[model samples]
Target: MTNYGDLVGGDRVHASLYADESVFADELDRIFTRGWVFVGHDSEVAEAGQWVTRRIGREPVIMTRDRDGSVHVLANRCSHRGTALCWEHRGRATSFQCNYHAWTFGLDGSLRAVPYPAGFEKDRVSLGLDRPAQVDSYRGFVFANLDGSAGPLAAHLGRGGVDMIDRLCDLSPTGTIHLAPNWIGHQVHSNWKMWPESDNDGYHLNWVHASMVSSAPDTYYQETVLGGETGNQSLAVDWGDGHVELDFRPSYRRELAWLGVTRERVASYCDALVAARGAEAANRSLWDGPPHGLIFPNLFLGELNLAIIEPTSASTMVHWHTAVQLDGVDEAFNRRILRQSEAAMGPAAFIVPDDAATAERMQLAVDGVQPGWASAADPRGWIDMSRGLGRERTEPDGRKAALISDETTNRGFWRQYRTVMSR
Candidate 1:
């Protein structure tokens, strides 16, 4: 262990945290594999024999529902030949057969049969598919872990963090959500860690997303991001366990309104939510927004979608963006939400590309500058996460809050990061 304390201190994180290959590998071993990471939404495999394949840490895994309605997380590789059992991202299937040797496994990942079973009389190999040590779901968000030693998923979700998922689900009239059929995925040459911190940093929104404001309708911009409007409506929240939320009032609808969604259209949308959860709760979930907060180690729930961050290397990551869909919403409402995802949250989305650029450029800076004697004070290896160090106030529920312009959430992420990595 390379003295993580040297790199991550009380008020600063070494930029090497993002640029070093060893540190990246350490993250995979100590944190990702050892902790629960989001796999797929429960609704994704809502049907019997349905499965969605995704990466958990560096290992490929599958979330499948069997005929008995039991959900199982399998390793996705064959027990016979070590080949991938399911290649398609998702599909409905009763069994997954190895493309190489015809070995097959049932929906629950139990070995159904084998080729020439008589020839294997003395064989002792476990023929069934490998499963993650533990798998669990909270509020329809499924997660899996490679290490059974890890604590339960809810324990990792931190205090009251599960409520965030529930609140997001409640945004739907049926009190549930499902990922749209097609997801928006983009690979970027940047460290995956960049996004966790980046997403938590609401302070950058006004500056980095100035273009977002300039491009929006003047009235909406004036009412929201312009001047003191942001401070009044926005809050910086540290939801602990590396879950940080940028909860703001009057955000989501403002974006739609800026893009020309009429008050009638917005009201109609809110009415469904109001009907589902009383006025106060609906207003909070739908209007007073917990805008696209990042739940650490690669699950991000935002204004419109669920994003999965998968790291390929020290400087490479791929993001999958799934549009949020209410199970029983009006078709037009679903279509409108999908359209918004296409327009603003997709790979080619206006805001996302900007975030990618910042991440890449920041990595370039770390790669571009060396800590020479002349630049020691401003070493390329260190990042100051000390902003708002002493300014944070804790809520009764243990959630930490700070000024919208402060880096309180960023530090909270580091604190958890250091704990996980050092452990």
Candidate 2:
């Protein structure tokens, strides 16, 4: 295997990584299989027998809340004839029964019963359902690893990543995050990395989101809102071990007002948050801003909520967008947030579709062609996470010329990609 870290720099990436089938398979093994990938939040399986099915790497997985009120993630295939147990995406059931053979399994993934009790010998294990190697949760987010011996989920996330999630959840008053039911799922005809890298590329804000820029009041421009006006929003790149974070400053309360959230309502939300987090910390808890933060590999929590990028192949990816809301918030408030999110971040949103289109074009350019590379030459040399590499900071919000040439965040993404793939 080639050491991608040695080959990738701030400026260029070997094109083979995107186009090669072997490289994609290796990534599925090394990164996706071993890492603690995000499955879904605990709220998704709130009741006994409630379940949701998903795919991690090449393996099919089902996460269920058992009658015992514990969450379990297990392989979806029946151990007998290797048939999928749960066919639906989500539902409530006492036990998963294999249609091919009458093998039944409890919600906790325990082998419950088989139709033909007398057919199989007492010592025969072929009739039982097999559970995943390991299952764990942190902050209500569940993850499963096929390798039982894989290290702790916290250790995999590292201290910094865990703290970020803590902050994200803590922002809510009830200490729970609810997924926004309304969302858009689109399949991108490009590698998964394309989505995250696009988020990190701050320079595209003015150009790629030109529609938003042209229509949205200039008061909300990245420069006016986060850069020159308040300097509240800043970018941070933390790279250590195999994980990384491209943290951007959150959007300000005033910015939320532009989205139709009134100042009084924003204050009320803050007051509720402060009551939960204490008066001293209430202001910090309200991250009412434009932030599309990335937790290396596949997890992304943007301004709206959690957006998952699951790879189907090197040229194809499944994107799932989930909106998170507080527990007691009214349906109207949640719907408003969902509406704003769909308008700005969903698939049909003005900005994301354009990005998908660009990625599809790039895939077409490099398909089947060997010995190709994508140049990310920012003025700050290779691996530059700096806010304004070459352009002048016009406003305090760190607004540099938002141009297509800026690849600061892309560099941050590829750096982590190289680190994990190299390992």
Tell me the TM-score of each prediction against the true structure: 0.90, 0.84
Residue range 64-163, candidate 2, lDDT tens digits = 8877789988789988789999888888898889898778887766677877688766644444555556678888878776666557887766655576
Give the candidate number with the greatest TM-score. Answer: 1
For 1-423, candidate 1 gives per-residue lDDT tens digits of: 576766777888777777777777888887778888888888888899888888887888889898888789999888876999878888888898888978888887878778888887644346677888889888788888788778877788876467678767776778878878876678888889888777667667667767876785343434444455234555678888888877655344442442246547767767877787788777666554435577777888866678888888988898888888877577787787787677666568767788888888988876542223213665556668777768789978888887665677787778888888888
Q: What lDDT would each prediction earn against the true structure? A: 0.75, 0.65
Which ranges of candidate 1 are over 4 A from the true structure?
122-125, 218-233, 250-263, 266-269, 284-286, 368-380
lDDT of 2: 0.65
Would you give me the overall lDDT of model 1? 0.75
- The residue-level lDDT of candidate 1 at 227 comes to 55
Q: On a 0 to 100 scale, what is the lDDT of residue 264 in model 2?
A: 69
